[model samples]
Target: MEDTDFIVNYVKSKLITINLEILIAKDGEDGVRKGQIERPNLIIADLMLPKMDGFEVCQQINSNPKTKDTRIIIMSTRNSKENVLRCYKLGIDDYLIKPFGLDDFEQRITRLLYS
Candidate 1:
């Protein structure tokens, strides 16, 4: 996961108790680097990231043959239809809006990871 401190910390805390390995990046560039290096099965990112922004990150990762099959769930406050369409166009698996409840977040993650 790559996002603000609060979101990253909160999600990390929640997943750690469940024994999940969380790789975090503070900016879009670092996120892309980690995505390439770690090759995680799922990536949860915020749209308004520093440096390159999440859209570009998704584009780059999805374009790469090594990471193209990886599932992506974008979390952001920008829930416009245009943004959602753009995410899907970039091959995102899911687009989750920010301020979502824990149950909703968990459900989305579960669906993407297990379904």
Candidate 2:
């Protein structure tokens, strides 16, 4: 399965118990546009995206006053310490490595949304 597909399904499964809207973006640019248009309460992004990288997407969202408050969760295969640190510096609310378990995903999402 593709990365976006996997992420969408995973998020859906975890959020099934709650009522929320899910938007799927094919790449970073789309994600940014959707973020601006939808003004979603939260965003989950992958590091390596088409068109623009996730870092750029996050940077744009964070820089914009309209979307700056949107909680961002970075989910990616890149688990290098530097990458993780960079995400934090960029103001991401949370970071999850790829191949994470459903329980962890749910917990993180819960913490982000509720806390």
Model-by-model lDDT, in order?
0.84, 0.85
After superposition on all C-alphas, the RMSD of every candidate to the true structure, in Å, is 1.3, 2.0
Candidate 2 has which clashing residue pairs, if any? none
CA shift at 70, candidate 1, in angstroms?
A: 1.0
Best by TM-score: 1
Residue-pair clashes, model 2: 0
lDDT of 2 by residue, 1-115 (tens): 1147766787777767676677878788889999999999999888888888878988999999999999999988899999999999999999889889888887888888987
Query: Against the correct fold, how does model 2 do in TM-score?
Result: 0.91
How badly does each model clash, as a count of residue pairs? 0, 0
By summed lDDT, the worst window of 10 consecutive residues in model 2 runs over 1-10
- How high is the lDDT of residue 112 in model 2? 85
